[model samples]
Target: MLLTQYLFQADKPLKTTIRNYTEADFNELIDIQKECFPPPFPSDLWWSEDQLGSHIRHFPQGAICAEINGEIAGSITTLIITYKGQDHTWEEITDNGSIVTHDPHGNALYVVDISVRPKYRKTGLGKLLMQSLYHLVVELKLESVLGGSRMPGYERVKDKLTPEHYVESILNGERKDPVVTFLMKAGRTPVKLLPDYLDDPESANYGLLMEWKNPFFEKTK
Candidate 1:
């Protein structure tokens, strides 16, 4: 499915399109990650070209990109996995980008990564990317969508509070965390707090375990 939206640039509406990922978008995907995420995190945490290609080949529908005037501005990569009934560390699921655990017939769609280029942020591209994934969840009859949300603003108050407290403050509106706030506003609920989730200092080495349940989920016994 193709989705189109308008993003304003100097009071002029620029056409933005959301479409499935293609093999040609590999380099731009890496470039966008560099632009959106801080150093080391992009290089240290992102999937390698071979891993990304493997994921796309396995679950093409879960990979998507947003473009404006032929430029790739944002992207979302996802995979399917059975729900692990306990708290999970990032390494346990992603396997350090090997993605060896991606289950094609799993019930939940896991958002491996989602990012928007710095210049295109706040132009609604991020929301569009997520919405595309949500629609995919519905189409595939999945139970929910899951992912870790980085608390980019956590470092500002890390010395004064724990990761849990920081998340609580943001949920209650006492603080505004860039990533958590955006995910919450987009209808994802914070289910748990992940400590040492990644190497990013901005997130205080923490993340929020989040999920968006599919409203149409039905049990088949």
Candidate 2:
């Protein structure tokens, strides 16, 4: 399916056009990433322009960008992966590298990254990007979408609670975590808490494994 057609069909709140990533978007996206995730993040964790290009080359449709006023305001990078029904960690999937491990025949759409520029965030661009992912999942006939959710607000209470407990609090409404709350509101469920999932100081090096099943997906032999 054409990315343009999907964007036109999906419900969006802002005046934005969602399209596949391009080489020119590389620098803007890198700058946006820097703004969204501030310093203290390991330099090696950041994907170089070439690595971002590799993702676009491997999964063109999976690399989506939201354009607002002729500028790249947000982006979502994804890949297909065979999800084994077992406990998994982020490192096991990415091999602790910037390169994406996209499996074309995999059954699940694995979201590698999703970010909205700091200036444009909370303007509904993030939701639009997620809608693009939903459309992509339908287009690919994938069963579900999966990704790690950084608990950015965890550090405030990390000294008193375990990662699992922190996630439980968010799930049960006992506490509010920015990323976890966003994912839950987007129809994703927190399946597990992964320790040391990413090198983010804000999340205390932890992540919540989130999944959203495609209600319209049909399984075939």
Candidate 3:
């Protein structure tokens, strides 16, 4: 993929800016996630007063958030393959082993979760979260960012990808997720699986894996 030859615009990011997460941002984060996701994560996800205390201690500068004109709109929890002084590259995350882990040595950023209240969906806040995660990865010096290209409570649905990537950003639907647009703006390419690696991902819609990084970040910024 010759991104440099394709069309460059690092001077303008996905039209969204980001900031750090804070207490005042918790309620909105909860509201948006709740509105977009179901079965909600542990109640602590929303009511925890330890909000910043939880992520900041774990990710330090990797936990990023955003606002739309002073209003809290979106947030993302990021883990570097290498964090602080330790590396988490050997760790694997699972939603009941439903999704497969392909790369343990890949340099990528995983977006643990992202949400923009239903009211805000299709309105660009989700794009903000994607952009913020992209920025966080650059600061951490990572090459790619990955997360489930998922629908909220996605296990009940089927994925579209046949095989998942080491780090995948995917979504379900008859169409590509708006996040795909932002991802393209950031420059992560999809993997072309070897015939042996081709198989249905255990999660929904095969898994719409997307990746982003580098010149995409530099040119967009």
Top-TM-score structure, candidate number? 1
Query: Would you estimate the TM-scores of all the predictions?
Result: 0.91, 0.87, 0.54
lDDT string, candidate 1, 131-207, tens digits: 88889999999999999888878888888998888888877889898888898878899999877887778887777
How much lDDT does each candidate structure score? Answer: 0.83, 0.78, 0.46
Q: With candidate 2 superimposed using the best TM-score fit, by how many Å does residue 118's alpha carbon deviate from the native?
A: 1.0
> For candidate 1, what's the RMSD?
1.9
Model 2 TM-score, all chains together = 0.87
Off by over 4 Å in 2: 1-14, 42-44, 95-100
Model 1, CA-based lDDT: 0.83
lDDT digits (tens) for residues 1-221 of candidate 2? 22332232234544578888888889988877887767765555666787787877788888888887678888888888899765656767754434367788999988788888887766666776887888888878899999888898889998998788888788788989887897787778887777778777788887788888899998886
Candidate 3's C-alpha lDDT? 0.46
Name the 10 consecutive residues with the lowest summed lDDT in model 1: 39-48
Model 2, clash count? 0
